[model samples]
Target chain A: MSGIVATIIAKYNYWIYICLMMIGLYAMITKRNLIKKIVGMNIFQTAIILFYVSIGAKRGGTIPIIEHAHGGQSHAVEAVHYINPLPHVLMLTAIVVAVATLGVALALAIRIYNRYRTLEEDEILSRIRGS
Target chain B: MKKLGLLLVILSGALLLYATVDFPLWGDPSSPASLHVSPRYIEKTMEETSVPNIVTAVLADYRGFDTMFETTVIFGAGVVCFLLLRVLGGEEGDHYYRHLPTGVTIHVKGAKGKSLSGEFERIDMLWTPYDLVIKTACRIMIPFIQIYALYVIAHGHHSPGGGFQGGVILGASVILLAISQNLRTALRRIGEKTVGILCAIGVFIYAGTGALCLALGRNFLDYAALASVLGTDPVTARSHGILIVETGVGIAVMATMIWIYNNVSSAGRYDEGL
Candidate 1:
């Protein structure tokens, strides 16, 4: 049991991401307000980004920017000395796409609000049924 | 229904947590992700591209196609939002204007007398008194913020920023202006047509760079082909190409962000909104 606890503690980043993902999922699933759902979606994206970035982290490693790189460095750059750049690069695109998604979602919400005059899913549904 | 959702969330959470047992521990250098193509990128980045920042080199050089499409995605989102929300033509609601000298507001019903002469400024229906402190503070800060944004884009090769981050900062500065003043004030500085055109232009710049490489009889986005045009060696040309692409990205991203904000804040009316 102690060994299992230690193992879980060592991989706590993944656990935290899982918790965050669950929270986002709960909000997305249960929230009636459209804006809340969008918030939940954002949280979900954040959790995924955090997960990828955490995977890229290396113990005692520096950022991927090479120091003294411009002045013709003498020493060779070791891969282990730097954190993973691929995930960061991928996540940069993900972050931009996430913002674009958020914008589109909000624009959609605005359109829905313009038409329905309310943002609640249930209210909109009932109104649709009544109409 | 809520209980069902809670149950589903708990089940998924447990499943994900159990799956985490197989994942490498946090910050493990030997993790699978670190062991893959990332190491080669980190080691060879400076040599191949002459860029100090591995992230920028990898993003703009190795994965240039992806970034181009990413810019396209941003542009598409902006276009979609514009289509969904933009309401062109005259606004039908009551128009509000403030007399500058007397500090008194005049409400004009209908679209008959829309234009206002000097000393009478148009305002939003939901307009509160414009805060002098906020306006003055942002006015002082806007120029500096814009300059910093330019720095972020230009210095991306050696630092933690690139076009996307810089572009967003530039867009945010404009957003700051809008929030500080009214939408129309911000719109006057950057008209709607200009923002839309800029959005397309940014993407065009990115795609155009790639096409330029292709025109030089090289593979798409192969910055090595740009050596002749830039009058630099192949390696340095790659670096310069990345900068060009980054600039394109910055412009597109900056314009898209502003475009989205303009449409969303005004709900396509281009008038009074927060």
Candidate 2:
């Protein structure tokens, strides 16, 4: 019990990310409106980005910017001194991709709305089924 | 159906939570993430690229090819939006304008651009109040915003921002203009044609740079090969190449975003866009 408690406490941030992910997942799965589903998808993406960024965090570390000498003397940078930059770089690209996807998705949604005059999934399905 | 969705969500969430047990603790210095090649990037970036910021170095120099494709992706999105929504040829009943100056009503034919002189202002179907506050504020701030965006792109080597963020900011300025003024006013500055050309040119610049390197007997997207052309050493040439590629990315992203906004907001009619 003590080991489990320690594990939970140590990895609490991941647990929070998991909770957020679940909320987003629930919304995406159950939301009827296409736009709502898109929002849920965005939320899910944000959760994943947050999780990746959190993995790079280090206790006593600064940002990824290097502090070097003006006189051209090179100093050894300790790995533990700075936060991991790879995740930040990857997430930057991910964030841009997410925005682009959202724009395209929203545009498609507008097109669908124009065609059917509705955004509800069930209405569209029924309309397709000729019921 | 809802129950099935709920069940699926629960299963996925549980599975993900279970997977979290193997992840490193928050702020663990010796975590796998910190032990890898990122430290080398941080330590060697200044010497290699002479960039003070590691993120910019990694993004522009270390991963230039990835950024090139990302820019292409944004351009593709713009093209997709334009293709989906653009309705060529105006509708006959689309024009019903009443001149505000003299109670004169003219039914404009689908004919393009033959409005009667400055004697008449075509009234809008969806009436909108001319917001002086927003207009004045945006007018005053647009120059500063554009200048800052350029600065951010140029200073990416030393700062927190790079091509993508700067491009978004630049695109936002155009969006702000469209919002504050009417879409017609905004379109005058950046027409649909201009956006298409700019977006294409942006991608071309990126790919062209890579191809240029290949021509110089180096691998594709290798900026270092342009050293002889730039009158600089290979390292400095790489630095300059990164900057140039980043510039291409910024321009591409900015044009694509504006194009997407114009298409989606107006639904390709190019009429009063949001």
Candidate 3:
């Protein structure tokens, strides 16, 4: 029981991320409104981004910015003193892609609304069946 | 259906939570992610690119190709929104125009190719009276927001912010303008043609720099090849190259965000919108 508690305490961030992702996924699957699904999708992306960024964190490390990188430093820079930058860099791209994806999805949603005059999935589906 | 969704969500969440046992402890410097190329990037970024922000160096210099494609992706999104939403030169229904002098609204039916004089301003079918406070506040804030965004982009080397965040802020100022006034007022400031061209131009600047490097007998996106052109040593050249690429990214992202907002808010009809 102590071991399990220790493990949970050590890795709680991942647990929270998983919970958030599940919430987002549940909303995406069950929400009838297109806008709600879009919001859910954004939540899912946010969870993943948070996960990646958390993976880059270090206990005693500062941000990825090098001190006196203009090169008048007396002390040599060590990797352990700074947080991992790779995930931050990758997540930056991911964020921009997320924004682009959201834009495209919202545009498509607008087009669908224009066609059916409704944003509810079942309503549009029934209208299609009637037509 | 909702029950099934909940069940599936719980199942996956539990599975993922179980998998967390294999992950490195939170904020562990010895994690596999930190053990690999991240160390090299952190150690060598200063020497190679002379940039304080290792993330910016890795993004613009080390991963230039990826960043280039990211810019292209944003531009493509803008183009896709345009193609999906923009409706051009169609027969719209009745036109509503408000005479400025008398505050009288005139409804013209089937007014195709009809031009109203300066005194009569076009209004949307669903028009709201302009609010003085919102308009004035936004107008005063817009220039400051724009200057801050420019600072974010230009001062990225020593700081946390860079092209993406700054570009979003810049694009948002225009969106704020659109919200405060109307779509037409915002569109008049930066025309549709200018936005479209600027979108392409930004991407072109990014790709053109890579092509320039290629022309100078180096591999694509190798900023060291820009040494002769930039009149700097290879290391400093890399730094300058990152800035140039960042500038391209800023422009592209700014244009794309504006383009997407313009399309979505107006639903492709270049008229009054919230």
Q: Which candidate gets the maximum DockQ versus the true structure?
A: 1
CA deviation > 4 Å runs, candidate 3: A1-6
Model 3 DockQ (Cα-based): 0.84
TM-score for chain B of all predictions: 0.95, 0.93, 0.97
Please give each candidate's TM-score.
0.96, 0.93, 0.97
Candidate 3, position A71, lDDT:
57
Give the Cα error of residue A76 in candidate 2, in Å: 2.7
DockQ of each: 0.87, 0.70, 0.84
Q: Which parts of model 1 are misplaced by more than 4 Å?
A: A1-6, B112-114
Put down candidate 2 lDDT per residue, A1-131, tens digits, no spaces.
99988777778889888888888888888999999999998998998998989988888999888765354777776767878888888888888788888888999999999988899998998887985
Model 2 lDDT, residue B123, Cα = 41
Please provide, for model 2 over B1-274, each residue's C-alpha lDDT reduced to its tens digit, 9 standing for 90 to 100.
6798889878987998888778777888888788887888877877787777788888877877777788888988898888888888754444646666676777676636556666665544664756999899999998899999988888787778877878888988998898888777788998889989999998888899999999999999888898989999887888888888888888899999899889888888777777
Question: What docking grade applies to model 2?
Answer: medium
DockQ of 1: 0.87
